[model samples]
Target: MKKYLLSIFTLIIPIITFAQDSTAEKFDAVFKEYTGWFVEGIFAEIPFTDDIQIPWVLFVLVGGALFFTIYFKFINITGFKTAVKVVQGKYEDIEKHGVDKLYGDQTPGGNVFETIKDDGADGEVSHFQALTAALSATVGLGNIAGVAVALSIGGPGATFWMIVAGLLGMASKFAECTLGVKYRDVGEDGTVYGGPMYYLSKGLKEKGAGGVGKVLAAIFAIFVIGGSFGGGNMFQANQAAAQFTKLFGLTGDNAGMYFGIVMAALVAVVIIGGIKRIASVTEKVVPFMAGIYVLAALIILFANFTLIDDAFALIFEGAFSGLGIAGGLIGVMIQGVRRGAFSNEAGVGSAAIAHSAVRTKYPASEGIVALLEPFVDTVVICTMTALVIIITNFGGDSSAISGTFMQYGVEVKEGVEITATAFDTVIPHFSIVLTIAVILFAFSTMISWSYYGMQGWAYLFGKGKITDLIYKILFLFFVVVGASISLGAVIDFSDAMIFAMVVPNIIGVVMLSPLIRKELKKYMNAINKKEDALEDGATDLVDEM
Candidate 1:
């Protein structure tokens, strides 16, 4: 693995040397040209008639979310208390050990592969670590950069739709992750390898659709690898590189390439250590980074408290009347839903991969815990970021484009830097601090996504040191290329790939949702009646004790 990584970096060093004499624009143009077709095809509009069209992925995501919301009876809302308690370890005793008298006591799967068995739970990481690791992936650029891009394109009206999408997404996230935990494979050495690839294949197989599940699983694995490269890896590098270069005025064709190399080197260190290492790092880093960014956002919001109502007024008014918008009503909706999906990734199924590693006996427990991601990510963090930008008039003069989001004086190229600019308005040189947060955000996201993509790669190629090395090499290569590309190409590809995971993921989840509902029903039943159940399990506990 080390030799392969070294060889790969050796090949890329020329690009850095070659870039010295060229302009960055040329790199962007070539990237856009080659990959443009994939982007166009994925985002192609499906017409409703002569005048109206929407990306069909939006329907897949929203439709599945709505179905889940209803089918599960709004588990996203009702499971809140359980989710909190589960994360706080209120149910750790039962989750780790056993409640033999419960609704349906699941025997831990760790015994299946005794080639190696670790002590404790069947799963690898704690619930909190799983949540933060997953949170690290979804929270960063989408909240900081993607939201900025959405507002710039969709206007304030998009904020309303963003919140709506986030709410509906909670249900989608719950179903996918519940199935993830239910169908996961615990390996001999205690390593976890699961995700949409596992659930779609395993869950559907149990539903008597084995052949269909196999095909869907393969497609999902391929899409996840691609999605990780674009949305999870490249888009992150692009934004971080853009912000880093802009802050220090680092000009030249290779500025982004130089930044990408450094980031890739840093990322290589942690990913080589695998999920446990990744989890340990993220638990500490994610909170500190998120706190710093959120605290800054809160301060800005308080300083401009008077504009809160007005900002919201614009959001609501723009949602209904997109008069100055490009695609008008539908355009605003697309941006909102797209960014919301991109931001919190409720239906994307990536969280299922991370959440699968959580140490819990009940599948629904992790799923319940997983629902908080969209609320915290999209509803809380993303909303705060949006409010700050809107309150500061951060996108620029709304009338500049004769009523578009073409904010005068704002540089869209910098992506996440725009958020920093909004912060700097209330606090001087805040972009400097923001640059640090962006780097950390990008770093955390890249590491988590590396694990996700690795899972998919292992699904397709079969897991081993060689397969892992090959995937890591390929992944790091994209990180560099992603940084050097133009924002439009990078973002278009990123959005297309990430949302594409929704296809297979949503199909399997919706079909398998009944099982998830039962899982939720059983888990909640056990939780609500734990006292009596625990009393009955005293015999089992006595043996272990």
Candidate 2:
């Protein structure tokens, strides 16, 4: 750890030496041009018609999600109660402590000894912590801002489709996270190295596709690393800094530089402790941040109690009719599906990395717990944002276009502010609160992404202590850089990089989905057996009494 602290200087000295006048200006231009080209190529949309187009990645995300939903027999709905129980530790004896006399110090096919010695509690965090860690990554701007953007273009009808997409996404999360834990490696020191990289290579290799799996794993690692830096860390920092600077009446792009540095320092403190620390922070911070946002949305919702029915009516009617929306029903559906899939990132597979650290013997148990991510993030929190917008009708009138696309004296990136204005309609001066929420959202997002990028970095660079140090230094540097600069293209490229992960991840998940099903069955059977054992023990006790 001393070596880790000292390594900060390794990055700092070079930045200081190069912090001259025109150098920063020259480098910014070069970075934007290079990233812009990548963004254009990666995010180029498939032209469905003159007025409507969608990215192929969105198709992969939504389609794979739908397929998983059906393929799993609506596990997202049926297994939801099981998922809640798993998080609440209802099956603790089944997963951790063994069920005595079930199979000669055994259970679950008489492998209790092996299960306890080899796999019992091989993880670093609790089910709740793993869920929160993953949730912290997805529950930020997407729920608050992206939902608003979808509603702005697609109208109230988009909310219906959004809920549908989020439901489908729940199954995708389950499949990938199950595969994540099944193929994960737990070190002698109890550190976990898992995610799509492991599952693609290990799980697919088990299916005799070693070459394809390795290539896919490598692609996933590269994309995740780039995404962690760009979309997950830098883009989040940039947006939060923007909102903070604006709300506080600060001027200049560099006005947020100091703010960025402070935020970076805070992130550095948390991430330096690794995933356990990250999970610990997230388990607290995620609920708090989400609670505050949800509570405010609830206030607006209940205050306009009369508009609730009208809001749902608009959502249902607009979703099917889309009369005022260009390209009709398809456009509204596309926007809602896009926002839903992107918000919770069900098929993107980053959540699997966080969920892989859960303390469980059965891979499918963690997978069940993982499915709740989309439920809380998209279905619940995002729906709150959508309802607030629909109820307020762009926070002004019952019109389609509220000039929000042109408001705020800037281009239509009014996601955070738009949601803020909706809340302010009832709460008054809630923008200050909203700004703090955005900053906290960004801060939590960056810390989790740092852990994600570190995992990817370890996959590529090998698992030495230096790997953690080097990744931390670079991550912290980007946090400051993101806040200090204004590079739309760079941010866009990063967003594309994040979506790029969907390709290899979903391919792996689909290929290994059969194994996922078997694992799920294995887990459920054990759950049943455990329940039977408890019932037998209870009957024996009553008889003895």
Candidate 3:
């Protein structure tokens, strides 16, 4: 597998490098033309109302999340404490059926003994590990660069809708992750295989909607595979490489290609080991990187504490007043919600692929845990990024700096640079630190997403070491391609692919919601009964012990 991957990588690199140079020049020309066309189109039709300016896609996502929220009777909110306890194993007796034991001294897939030996008990990685793995994918450049772009176009008001969109998204996360565990397939060797693919196919089949289920699942898998290659893997490496080159003032345009190769090589090393290794790496990298970035944001926030109120006022005013450029209030809201959805991906169903690998028996346990993702990624992290930019502009003529294409006063050029500028404004030399943070965030996100895409590829094709290798190789190749080239088209296509997963995933979730409800009831009942027993025993112990 390694030899085959290396051979493919070797052949692809030079071709990608040459193609990227040509593509970049072409992209610059086309992007300029397209931006004009896009802006004209926006003005032509959507005479933006603040409330109505939000895209139909955002409505679908937010509405879907709201539906799940009500359908599950606010499980995302009500189950938070229980979810934490489950992750801590306080409710283990309710979730685990029996004592977990690793296969005892047996070879891989050899016999019953081997199977037993490999069939490890539940809780492979801790609930925190699972959360970190999922977070690693969602909390990347989108929170940093993407939010800056949104705020620039949508004005400060975008931040308000971003938070609203994120809050509602929690329910959607709950639904998909619940189904992820509910229908996860366990292999004979105790290897776990699960995701939206398994649940969508199996759950719908159970509901006697087998044909629809299979078709939707297949479509989702295809998009997921594409997304893994494009947005998740390539886009990450591309952005990281670009930022790295920029920070060091690397000269040759092909520097990005070289950086991509290094990034791809590192990814190949980790992914070759499969989910166990991927999960382990993310558990460490995600927390460390997130902590560093958040701590830095916090420091900036404190340094500019007096400006915080003004930032909030501007965000609220811009969101509702539609006083800036673009289509109006609605356009600003659309930009924020659209970007937020893209960032955290609550309804898109990609995160379920990672969360499904958890060792828990109760699918709802993971569902409840999954809700925390959007809060952390969009609500907390993205908000901090937005606040930094807003605070920087406080008491200044932000409109003077707004670029030609931007609708609001926020600047559009060099999003990462703009963010770094904001940081540097408060703390000199912070740009260097932010550049490093961006690289780490991008790398961690790409690796985790590579796993997501591989699972989708295996589902669509067949599961084998060969198939896994093919997916990883292709994924790495795209990383280099994304780094070296102007990938507006590719990113657009992948962005669509990511959103496209929403329809089928939501269909499967809605269809299988009854099953999720059933599981939730079963798990909750078990918890209730266990608590009752404990209370009764405690009363008895008062007389006995």
Candidate 4:
């Protein structure tokens, strides 16, 4: 497996390198043309509302999130405090209580912090570590660049729908992550393997739909692997490279290619260590970078304090106004929801890969934790990004920025550059800081996604050292390819792959919701019993972290 992956990597690297010099312009032209076709052929036809056109992917994602929100009775809302407590180790005993009983000498399959520090449990990382890993992947340039694009096309009204979509998405995240932990597999060496793939296949088989479940799971795994390679790794590198080169005024055609090689090398070093290393690095990087970015956004907001009320008014007005600055109410809503879904990845099921590594006996515990992701990524971070853009254009005519005049339906102008301009408007030289932030965001995303893709790769081939090495090598190679060459086609296909995972993933989550409900009930009962016993002078079961 290692040799096979190495050979493929070897072959692909030369092609990518050669293409960088020989076919760079050709590739860019082809990709642009392809993107136009994709927009017209597929994206244009999807209906956003009963009367307006939107992408079908948006409907699937939003509708699924809404369904999960109702089915779970708003666990995202009810369990928010409990989720914080669980992550803080307040309910550690409940998660660890039945572990020894279930597996005896062998470690149970899931514990939240196994990745950061090994303890012979099913968990591959701490709850916080897992959260960071997931966040690193979800909260990338999308919040900065993608949100700007959405606001550009959808208008300030889009921000309102983005928040709505994110809130609903919390429920979907909870459902899928709960299933991820509940149906995880623990290997002989105590290595934990779980995700939508495991639950979709195993959970369905348990329900007497083995054959169908296996096929769907296999398809999902394949797409996930592709997605990890393309959207998760390559596209991230590509964008980061572009930003870096643009900031430095690197004019040569091969400048991005040169940047790609450096980025790929850095990615390869971290990915070689697998999820444990990736989680460790992200646990630190995610918080630091997020703190910096959010702080900058806050500064801009405070500096432009008077515009806050106006921003809100515009957001509301634009959201409901029958005549949007561009399309209409539905158009803005679609843009907001699409951007929000893309940024937070609530229904994409990528977070399941990270959540599966969490150490917990009760699956609902992680589900609660997972809900916070969309809230933070989309509801909070993406909102801040939008506010920066909207607030920057507060006094100006918002319609001027809308891409309605362009033949290719409305799009944002230089989204990354627009975001940088917004930041620099308030804080001088902040673009330098933003460029650094973007690079970190991109690198962290690539590393975490390397683990996600590797899991799928391992599942398809085999979970051996060789297979692991192969996947990482191929994944790192793509980082360079993504940076060096134009890959809009690859990015589009991979974005679709990521979105497509939602189909089988949502099926598994819905199918196994009963089990999730059962686990939630059991965990709640344990918590209640513990509280009762404590009132009666019983010893507390929680272990201090």
Best by TM-score: 2
Better of 1 and 2 by lDDT: 2
CA deviation > 4 Å runs, candidate 1: 1-7, 15-37, 48-52, 101-120, 323-330, 394-417, 484-491, 532-545
Q: What is the C-alpha lDDT of each candidate?
A: 0.81, 0.83, 0.76, 0.79
Q: Taking the candidates one at a time, how many backbone clashes does each contain?
A: 2, 1, 9, 14
Locate the minimum summed-lDDT window of 10 residues in model 1: 110-119
* Pairs of colliding residues, candidate 1: 395-407, 396-407
- Greater TM-score among 2 and 4 belongs to 2
Tell me the tens digit of each residue's lDDT in model 4 across 1-545. 34554565567667776887647667766766765564344343565456677777776788889888888788879988888887787767657654333222323565443342434336877788888999999887888888888877777888999999889999988988888888888778767788888988899999999998898889889989989988898889888988899889897767877787778767776877767888899999999999999999999999999988888887888779723455787778788888888788887788988899887777788888999999999999999988887777654355324332221135756778778888888899999989999999999999988888888888889888878877777787788788878766768877777877877787777778888888788778766766666677754534434
Ten consecutive residues with minimal summed lDDT in candidate 2? Answer: 536-545
Model 3: per-residue Cα lDDT over 1-545, one tens digit each = 67887797788777876686566678656755655553333223333444444444555677788889899998867987887787677755435442122111234553442233232235455567778888998887888788888888788888998987887788889889888877877666566677889988888888898998899989999888878887787778778887898789997867888888888888888888877888899988888888888898999899889978877887888788765546567777777778787789998898888888787666777888888889899899999999888777554355422433333544476678777878788789988888888898888888888988888888888878778777878888888888877767667667667777887888788878878888888668666766665665521111100
Cα RMSD to native, each candidate?
4.9, 4.0, 6.6, 5.4
Q: Please list the residue runs of candidate 3 whose C-alpha ends up more than 4 Å from where it truly belongs after superposition.
A: 21-54, 98-124, 323-326, 397-413, 537-545
- lDDT per residue (tens digit) for residues 1-545 in model 2: 64654566466545633542466667767887767777776777999989889888888998898899899999999999999998987876557643342322333455434333332567889999999999999988888888877877787788899999999999999999998898988887999999999999998899999999999999999999999999999899889988888887899645657776778888988998888999999999999988988999998999999989878887888889884776678888998898999899999999999999887778999999998999999899988998887676543545443433322112246788778878888899988988888888888889988888888899999997877788888898888778877656667777888998999999999999899999999889878876775666632111100
Q: Give the best candidate by lDDT.
A: 2
TM-score of each: 0.87, 0.91, 0.86, 0.89
Instruction: Summing lDDT over every window of 10 consecutive residues in candidate 4, give the lowest-scoring window.
Output: 400-409
Q: Which is superior by lDDT, 2 or 4?
A: 2
lDDT of 1 by residue, 491-541 (tens): 677667777788888889988988998998877776766666555663223
